[model samples]
Target: MANSNDSWFQTTAAREIHLEQLKQAERFNGRAAMLGIVIGIITEGLTGAGIAHQIGLGPLVDGYAACRTQFLPFCF
Candidate 1:
């Protein structure tokens, strides 16, 4: 009898099941990426801010610059 703990790739049926799961995961990942792109574009069009600014990195960068120049306590 085969060991219950044997790797799935050792059998044809297990390999097919694994491949099908991979395909489903790939499809879901692709859809999620497309949705993110669409949302970013729409948000940019509505708010005039790029994705980075929309996600709030803009202010953080500005603060870093300010701290470098003025030695602000918040920089710590």
Candidate 2:
């Protein structure tokens, strides 16, 4: 009976530890995703490639049009 109880306790402890590690990993991944979004916004702002420019195809539209038939959407 004592041996059985000891084995059960050990299994429970290991399970708890594994659960805690998984929670910590989830938090870290959430933070990393947020950090990536912030960095992406910063990059777009600095590079002047905001939503408007991207949707309008700004300076690259001409290139695309020039080879639209050749590349299906991209020139060269």
Candidate 3:
């Protein structure tokens, strides 16, 4: 009876450790999301500049305004 109880305890502990590892992986992704936001800001500036340079600021702003009215993400 004692050995069987010990085995049960060990399995429960292992299960908890696995759960914590999964939680840690999700938090790690949240940290990576911060980096992604920084990258997105840089890309947004570059994209706006590229559009204005190639087309014109008026058209670039118009396109962004249209997207803002129509889409969820709004071009970026």
Off by over 4 Å in 1: 1-10, 59-76
TM-score for every candidate vs. truth? 0.62, 0.62, 0.55
> For residues 1-76, could you state the per-residue lDDT of candidate 3 as single tens digits?
9999999999999999999999999999999998877776676687754433443454446577557576435663
Per lDDT, the best of the predicted structures is 1
**Which residue pairs clash in candidate 1?**
none
Q: Ranking by lDDT, best first?
A: 1, 2, 3
Model 1 TM-score is: 0.62
Can you write out model 1's per-residue Cα lDDT over 1-76, one digit (the tens) per residue?
3575454436867788899999999999999999998999999999898887888766556687557766466773
- Model 3 segments beyond 4 Å from truth? 46-76
**TM-score computed on alpha carbons, candidate 2:** 0.62
For model 3, give the RMSD to the true fold: 7.3
| Model 2 alpha-carbon drift over 4 Å, by segment | 50-76
Q: Candidate 2's error at 49, in angstroms?
A: 3.3
Which 10 successive residues of model 2 have the least lDDT summed? Answer: 65-74
- Full candidate order by TM-score, most accurate first: 2, 1, 3
Clashing pairs in 3: none
